[model samples]
Target: MRSVNYARPTPALAIHDLRKSYGDLHALKGVTFGLNRGERLAFLGPNGAGKTTLIRCLAGLTSADHGEIFLAGQPFKSSEARQQIGFVPQEIALYADLTTRQNLEAFGRFHGLRRRVLRDRLAWALRWTGLEDRADDLVGAFSGGMQRRVNLACGVMHEPRILLLDEPTVGVDPQSRQRIFMMLDELSATGTSILLTTHHLDEAEERSDRIVILDQGMVVADGSLDELVEQSVGTQRLVRLRIDRPLSAPIRAGVAEHAASFGATGEEEISTRIDDVSDHLPGLIDLVRRRGYGIADVQVEAPSLHHVFLHLTGYELRD
Candidate 1:
């Protein structure tokens, strides 16, 4: 008799062969990925890249045409999986006339949290959002940032196992954005999985554990910043040097020999595009200095996430 092998426990979320369509349009084309427990994954892409469709399917608001999603080892279509997921949309959903405490209590009850559990969750939600002092005040009376915080607190009131956030930091002050991320960090520390979609590249690059880039319903790139940069942009770095005075024609020719390409930007500034600035910069600077010019300024710009995005997806604006 053959021995039986049980499957390993699934991660917080596993999406396989996700496909969705609208008439002639294929929104998601066999999308597949897995998110680890306590991981923060940022989903990014150009407009109309199926981000909304994917989120809808994950949140259980819309059924996928063909796919399978498992949450914490349970089929995503099951009630158990649905109960463990929390969603925070771009638009605020709290009742304006209700107080912060009232909103949380209503959400907690709707999630079937009862008695002491509801009370404890509500108190923690208020304290986590720094809304304990304003618990009795109407949500409409709060600032945009405060209201955003309330909106977040409501989604988290049930202590969900996984959270999906869509542009949670949109239209808020920097301080509020910081608080929102801090709150998310705390949740992640407690072992909650997070999936985020936002247009803020810097925020995604800074906060996410891993990033997945979708373009026209396909996974074009997936990895950390260093990994993506190495694959897409190579080891190149942009170096700009300005001198007190422009070099003579012969001296300019000498600088060009050491650079992949050198061009005059301003009166005394020259731009050098090179791979591994550390190797070429010293030589280039010495070459320029020997020609009787003082180095006025030096600027080194690295390839960034934005550059990688534009590289994979063109610079044309998407509606």
Candidate 2:
């Protein structure tokens, strides 16, 4: 097995001015981004937003009409650069009739892994994907989640330095999703750069090192969650608190002083939009407590990637 150096500082992937089109219809328009070694970059975009085309271009499945790509500082179009990348598409690519072990073996062989290296990779892939117990079982007999894991395992059998995943956890249970993230985390720890395209906003916010959003075949937004929030919604945070009962005149006045606007109202619930909840919530809670009112619940709403997406792109459905 080849050793991976986690301390390398070079970027694992880079693309500049990538453009693709199908005659009159353009798929990607001047998209540019880079993935640092061992980092997890989440790619997000609306339907028909050039995400699939970009992924296909990076994986060499479809050549970009115009662009420059580099893998580990080498020309991405070269065969040597291709060896450093792995792709796990949204669909399951393994043969259902093949046993789990057989499927992995086939992938390993396809990657040109042989002799002791192939055996070791086969063992490691099964164990890493938690399929050791089902190694002899046919893939057709496994659950959807299990099949997803096998699909992921096959993609990385060659131990590529960079992995690209598209909707890897779609339709899977929470447990399976957690396991897949954990495996990806381990891979990142071992210096594998990852570019993940997922619809799960929470996962992208929590798991990714950086996030990029594309719209209309162009790069609309790219940054961390905090940066994106600041760009989209400024320094605002929503605070929803439920008091024991309706707030009195004095309490309402106090809340009004801190709130820019009010939201949904209930008998005991108060929703206020504040500039920053982290700085004001403690004071508000304390004041409510001093007024003989017990707080039942509190929810802070921050600008999420989903919100930014909707704000940037209209809510109309796309084909």
Candidate 3:
């Protein structure tokens, strides 16, 4: 029998041939990926797509039956590996009776920080998370968003090299979400590699350096935003045109012929996906004029990450 060798660390986080199963259900099917130093990547998928399972395996909260995980160029099973990574779980992990400062102090000490260092780290983390003014307030009295911020502060107080965040903005308000994004942006600037899992498509598009879309324990797509869109949806652009007069049958047929796909709203507006806008727009205008109709407005919409997900998986991400 050939024994599995698991000592290696090439990237900030690397998993090869990772497999995990729970009795009859397969939670992860050989999931593999690499995150480089200072990279911000988003893990995107519907519920039950194994995103949480993968995170647990990396965090050592669960053991993989087969496969290997490496952190910072070393086996992830080691204590050194665990110390190098910080995880903010989907659930709020904090002591309700503890103050914000106390929470950080407790977690910092768990990582074996000295008392003096722990205090300094607690102060800095409170300031960094914008909880300096509320440091003495019991967590039980804090708002949901404030608690979420403190949860993250506790995980990151020691300045770990990599951060794994699982739906950190699930229930937060818009302002709190914005604040968290701003903080993550600052962390990225300081060269902290971050792997976040979220269902917020717009937020992921704006924040992640790369997006990995998973479905049914498989990676359906992975790349930068533009690359994934272009790979999945081709070159067609969505266009919506509003006309002064209702579309005649012949004009509608003409529009369909010029567009790869199109739909009409009785007669006032037409939405279409076309290959070449410059080539198709003039022809569309000419057709409207010939049909005794006038063009009132035209709008073009690019394919978003949502559309790309649908195109690749044939189902909405939420479904």
Q: What is the C-alpha lDDT of each candidate?
A: 0.84, 0.85, 0.82
Highest-lDDT candidate? 2
Per-model TM-score, in order, reads 0.90, 0.86, 0.89
Q: How close is candidate 1 to the true structure, as a TM-score?
A: 0.90
User: Which 10 successive residues of model 3 have the least lDDT summed?
Assistant: 1-10
Candidate 2's residue-wise lDDT over 1-319, tens digit each?
1223435665788899999999998989999988888888889988889999998888888888888998878778646655788899999999999999999999899888999999999999989999999999999999989999999999899999999999999999999999999999999998899999988988998889888998889988887777787888665777878888775544543345654433233357766677767688887777667767788999998777778777767788877
Model 3 agreement with the true structure over 244-277: per-residue lDDT tens digits:
8665553454344553323443568877777888
Cα lDDT, model 1, residue 103? 93
How does residue 292 of candidate 3 score in lDDT?
74
- Weakest 10 consecutive residues of candidate 2 by summed lDDT: 258-267
Alpha carbon lDDT at 25, candidate 1: 95
Model 3 shows how many backbone clashes? 2
Ranking by TM-score: 1, 3, 2
Candidate 3 residue 30 C-alpha distance from true site, Å: 0.9
Q: Which residue ranges in model 3 land beyond 4 Å of their true spot?
A: 1-9, 252-266, 276-283, 316-319
